[model samples]
Target: IKPPSTESVAVLQQVPIKPLTKPLTYPSLVSVVEFISFGRRKQLYAKCPTIRKLEERLPYHLERVEIETIGPGYIILKFDNFSVGPIGAYRNEISMWCPGKRVTRSTNLSLYEATEKFALYNLSRPGTTIKTLETKYTPKCILNCIPLTIENYVVDGNDRDKWIIRTTRPVKTLQTDFIIRHDTIKYAKEVTVTRPSHLPIRIHTDILSEWNCESITIERELTHVEVVDYCRKVSKRTDRPIRSVFKSGLGGYSTELFQMLSRELNAKKMELEGFFGNLIQCATIYINESTELSVLMMEPEIWIEVSTTPPSTVLQPIKPLTKPLTYPSLVSVVEFISFGRRKQLYAKCPTIRKLEERLPYHLERVEIRTRGSDYIILKFDNFSIGNFGSNNESNGKIAMWCSGKRVERSTGQSLHEATEKFALYNLSRPVTTIKALKTNRVLANETLIFLDTPKCILNCIPLTIENLIVTDFIIHTDILSEWNCGCITIEEELSYMEVVDYCRRVSKRDRPNRSVLKSGLSGYSTVLFKILSRELNARKIRMTVFGGNVLEFANIPINETTELDVLMIKPGVLKIKVCARRTAIDRAF
Candidate 1:
């Protein structure tokens, strides 16, 4: 395999979750382009109730924000008591932007006070930071911004015409639903205003124009490859490692991407616009994930940038609107990388669980080798195929590896047979006989017996066999009444004490007067009893010489008009008792 494309390779692992304890650092202004595109308007919406509430309470002081938690749908931000003295005497107030809380302010009388208070108390101490947005609005913002910037970059062979529109609205925002729409794009076509609204006065270009600020228009266009290359450079400035993100297949500027970007921007105390979400969406879809952005760059007059609105709205010889830039492919490279070797193995191995279960110990490794046309040898580690002797090292030696051991066997033989022989060999003299054991059973000519191990109750022999052919004696797991010496038959072994104890336990656990034994218990005990008694006041069962024990039969249920009969032919010689009932069981002679 050519090692699959880089796009198909998923991130081998995610960075372990460690708390980012350091105070947030701000990125340079030149790095802002990585977070937002100059080609379009930008916005981000935060729906987390905590974020929305914090938006109302938090005052911005032109300081970087930091995250306390970042997982799934939850995020928290940490802040300290505010001081604005160090910022400078001229700068009385500073503004910081975040989702939902669009603008936050910190105020100080002098530079000394601002700078002294500028160091937040919580930045290095125990605190909270909302690292991610918990809302539906952010994803929508990401989706919608793509089209607004589509005209700036050519897609495939299509070129865009017409001058862009610049709208400046009032700075004083009212608590009303402000919805905006664009006709061309598929995603993020509309944006609904948030509740307890705070509109950014700075972005209200009309209000900002009245200030002493100078108007500057910077326009430039780059090829698709150039844009991707530029993103690589910008990633360093943004501290996002944008190239790796694309290679790992999380390239699309989806809501998730925007969320990450917002976290970075927050940590850096960077300004963010509503359409930055869209700008990221466009960069992720066009430049990063696809070659179309590069293809667009190859054509002339494709890459266009006019950051500041020109003095004359009608100054340019504008071309008519051509066909809109359409992104035909939305499949993200992230998908391809996420399905890695683990997923490939999952697709191949349907019975992997069964294979794991068959191992005697925790399987450290497995080597599958093809033998003949149809056969395969699976050699597994972390288990021993045979018993270890005094001379052998403790490292789970195989039977063949154990020199001069009593249970030495050929490794080439069937694993099941070898294991069975070894187990039987070990149980020879001092070990308790199977007849004396209560919970163990002998299988396959006494070669293998049930042995209790520390980790599990049912431990398999060192070998696995499927469909072993039986040459003698049929084994029956059901209840049996008779024993034949000539043909060996097997069932759950029953003893006198077992029968007594089972009934006693059931009586104590269930309704003692009328208890019902299941079929499994009946099979295990090899006897089904229906006991009847007329003594309502008798707490203990009345026993007869013929009955095995009073306690065992006492718990066994019997009906009204039922009789228990015990047959004794001679002294100390007893036969089975037959119980008869009018509506229950028939009498047996």
Candidate 2:
């Protein structure tokens, strides 16, 4: 009876409980999406299509996202910052590429299923914006499913021809790790291809040859044969009037091409020697007076460069009293353009770089000066043109000033990273003459980009130097053996064996243009006379404790000359004069 009364009492009052929160508004729904666990979001999508659409419609901002279909179809969310990925199939896939505080819980979905579900839930709608989308060996099905606005698209080894960069606007930067699609390149303002060290980004040379981009850089070293073939394409690239094509070589000297260029085009033939690192030269092969291919051999690699003279000269002015200053007639004037202006033109865009390459410019001085450990300044013509150092205002960017005006910048990149761009541009600038290039140490970026500062200078140097004077720099035996200059004075120390080796190498050189090894080294005081007399079987060498220009007439005492070929040996430094083997000293006295 008591229980029945208690049950009847409950019926007198009916209590209603309301929802703790109301129906989420659109903004509220987005806010919920933001804080909701990725696992719960996936579960919500798994339940109904409507919730999936809602998830997609609400904006989910990501700095970067990487989708890799090649390995179990992995979709790494918040890849740049709050990483939550390698989602598991058994709700316990805790393994993450990023081991940090911000971790996403794993779920009961395989990588393939999780990737698809994430794409459907997070990427299918209109409000998703991935600042940078990285796809690695992703299949076409997944690529098609990923319908989001990507600002920058990075493709890495899409082995299945899934090379795509679908963006709302032209991709800011298309970074292709190895495989680069010809069609995909036109969709980007700048295209950079970084291939694995062992593999070159296999691409159609013709397609890349005519690419007109803000900047297009492909890190591929072609074989000598491929270089010639590429040059052939650039030669026939008449549609765009390609001024030149610069390609790095695999460090092979194509002597046949050199000979052909020299003979057919009436060009100077150069004999390559690996005295220093590789035989170095700036030899040109003229297809005609208008079109020429420059083959430069710097240690470690050969560079294939083509400079096609445009339809008209770049110096003559149109319709003037002395010479008319019409805009059309200023083509030849590009040859006389200042180094600063030429550099600016090169940095502008691809088309301007092409135009700037057609005419050779002379740079009085290009100095790579390091101010402390942090800054690397490239000074030109005795002016503080640019520095690759970071300062407060720069915000870790590179600021370049041309003629007292800030022309351009390297935004959001380290000093080492920015140096590569400048090195690439500097290597292509048609600088026929660099009076002096000074650098204390070899400059390489942190990434160790292929063309370091030292390599760049070596490639830019012309075959012949006017008056070469190297001071405070370490000069080696190779330099003494190979330098082709009018008057050479090297403030370098060399042992007696080095001086003797210089003559031996000189004697071994088969090239017709031979330089006489005449030098005065302080290293070989009285010792050189004894060694030379022993090595050369000298009839009579004056007993001078300090010799002067030791073995000036080579080790052999050739009586062909009146004065004895002297070996001037000092004590600390070596002063070497190398010229065409002329009337060398004879030990007639």
Candidate 3:
């Protein structure tokens, strides 16, 4: 049914949300004055004229102006042709209803009521003039309502109906807690803070000092005495007192001068005059007379200065000390005798002379005979005179003689040389004879003989000689005969006979006697008796036993026996028997 009268729906207009802009600029001087004189107590000064005109036309006493399209809740306001300070400069931007609001704008309602009562009573009471009235009511009300409190109050001179007020509520407590965090930073220049408790505060005017300067942070409760003591210690460390040691030497200065000076300098004011007087006296003495000389000579030297006089000395006679003699009588005499006559006697009676005289004539004869190099035969004549020469001819002269195969009168060579050469050719050759002949005519009678020879020539004599003779004969029949005889005839006849006779005599001496009584005879007696009987028989000495048991050799008794002769015993049993020749005799059994 409405289609015959169709109609249009109405659309409601949506208002644009505008950012709230704070009034942070000063108005023109004329406008500010006019606004203060008028009753516009809550007016804001915009920096821009257009923003200020638009804000003045608003119906509300409190208004926000947005001058640019920055974003929601952000603004740039301009009023009175000046720059806007910053966005969010107004007090209303801070949320007073935030959960953790640090500061509040509202006052205590109870305290505000009490304060109003006090102010109203004080104003209406009598005798309360301006002079007697206290300003406590104004301070109390401001403390209660901080945000709405009037910062400046003025009375109007022309318009008695109007009162002027200026108010400011800090948006934040100077943003003192604002902190800029950083990492890895080094500061080259000094940093300063105007107010250390207020961030974004005017720096130079308030703080005006270098940052990070070294300083001691003492607690507030430290006493003045403690601070003074601490400062004294620090001053001591920073500034040390000078030390000087004074010694005496310069000019006539002595140790006393230094002592006086030190005392005067260190004395208290009350005592300074006394110490100074003493110092002056010391200085005067040090500068006077020979005191300078003493100081100059103060160093040690070889010359010693004596303070006392030397004592007198007395001379006395000197005596030498002597020691008694310790010589012994026996020792003195023995030493003298040994060095005098006794020494001479010992020299004359030495054993060498006795030994020379005591040696046997045969050894001397052998030594003299062997003293010369001559194969000579020495012989003794009938007169026992010694002589020798190299000759095979027989001479009838009877004297000691020596002969050789050859003789050299010029070179003193003889047959001994030839014989020695011959023995050298045939080592088995035997030495026949050695003789020394007289050569010195002056001593020929007493000392020289055919046996006398030079001592130098005796050392070469060979050991093969069986017979050696030294004689003083010119001719000897026996020697001649012996020379001619052959060795076999000599060995078989004369030598053998001599040997047999020697053996017989030795046996006889060794034999024992058996004729003695049985009790007196030892076991050797029978053996010795048998040996004697055998030897006597071997010698052809006949013996016969008589009835008296006497052993008779050619009717003579032989009793003595020789030593070292072995006796043989006949092994047989014996029986006691008795026989009688002239008388009965006992016989061995």
Candidate 4:
């Protein structure tokens, strides 16, 4: 029972093998086939897998077999049957399988071999053959007979390929010549063959022999040359004659004259001394020459030698002295004289004169003698006397000498007065002094006589004083005694008065005061004050009269109509008050 059960189990596991699955065949061919062949022989190669499989299935009686795998992943099956035809000739047949299927359908392949000869037909129709030719060949016998000849020819051949046929040529072209010849061969033909991939293969052919040419000459012609005689003729024909005409005083010679004048002027300019005055002289002469030339061709040469002379010695005219002559009296008296017409009269009796009659009064004779260039001696005699004493009772000895201007004195009242008055007066006028050397008494109202240094007198009074004295004495005669004294104190007072009066007169006469409105209140009030302060600090303006407020004297108007922003005690501190209608800006004057 166990054996019969085991057999049944084995039968159940076998299940009859499923009928072999349709003979285990591959799919039908779905891609085209291609083949390549060597010409004139049965050397066909299958370039596609479908064609290769088909050829592999063929009987071994057809040809020699080879299998090649091409670079693009295609298989080739080559069969050679050399006895069938020429070295290279074949037809290609292509076969392909249907889409979405394996390569199992078998058909002829269409293929091409690079070495196969192809027909080039005319462009008009498919059946028209333009030409038919075999691929070029050299017979083995010919090649063997002249091995060295062929080799030498090929080594020096014009064609760079060095083919076996080139070895038979008689004359070989050099490489450089070959290049040049090729460039000049315009009849050369080039063709391009494109594959289904659109890649092109270029072919070039030299058809010189077929085009009726035995040989080609690659030499260039000389197109341009310069012959010596031709060049000489050209140069001579282009050459110009330079003719210069010299005319003597002719009309057409203007340009020549102008050129000549220009050269001469330039030469003269080069020789010039470069002083502006000299240049001006040359320019003037040039203009003059140009003007003359413009008028006529031949103008007379006017040569003006303009050499400069050294500047002449200039004598400054002497300025006549304008100061008045002053003399000192022996008895505290003063006198003055003009220096012009009365010069000779002063040598006789130096005295003052009345302003009206211009005559001397209170006569007292005195003689003056010059001791040196600047020293003098005076002699007084019988001088009339008044307040101090009689002239006969006083000593007659008096002398005088000149010195610098009197700047100071010792008498209290007179010195103070003179200093104060002269301080102002000295701003404009200067004084001169003469020292007395002898004692002389001069009355208050008598003519004062000045004596020589040895002996002289005036009313027997001594004329020696520290300050200058004025006298009431008048000049009644044309003598040295025309001066007389007033009071001594009055004299001092008069000196102060003279200085003050001179200052006042000069201040009034030289610079008069204009109205504030005329000068513009803004200028004197604001601008002038600032300028004055700056000038005072710089010592340009001095404080001369110090007793009064200058602002009050300036006479600026002030009224209730004016407004005052602030009353400034000093520069920074101010008293601020608002006025209804009295601000300073409202003021008109």
How accurate locally, in lDDT, is each candidate? 0.25, 0.52, 0.24, 0.24
lDDT of 1 by residue, 412-505 (tens): 5444334444443322223121211122222433343332221111332233321121222233222112221211212223333443433333
Task: State the TM-score for model 1.
Answer: 0.16
Instruction: Give the per-residue Cα lDDT of candidate 2 at 462.
Output: 44
Residue 16 displacement (Å), model 4: 89
Score candidate 1 by lDDT: 0.25
RMSD of each candidate? 35.1, 26.1, 66.4, 50.4
> Could you tell me every candidate's TM-score relative to the true structure?
0.16, 0.40, 0.12, 0.11
> Per model, how many backbone clashes are there?
35, 24, 32, 59
Comparing candidate 1 with candidate 4, which one achieves the higher lDDT? 1
Ranking by TM-score: 2, 1, 3, 4
User: Per-residue lDDT for 1-589 in model 4, tens only?
Assistant: 4456887889888987667555323433211111222221112333444444444332222223222323322333322422111113234332222223222222243232211111111011211111111112222222232222211111112233332322222322221123212221222221111122242212122221121111222222101111111112222221112110111112122223333333333212112322211111121112221121111221111122212222342233688868654433322232233222222343445453322123222212233333322233332222211111112213322211222211112232322232223222211212222222222223323434433221222222233333332233322222211222211122111122232222222222212121000000211223333432343221121222222312111111123432112122112211212222322223322
Q: Which candidate is the best by lDDT?
A: 2
Candidate 4 global Cα RMSD: 50.4
Runs in model 3 with CA error above 4 Å? 1-458, 466-505, 508-589
Judged by lDDT against the true structure, how good is candidate 3? 0.24
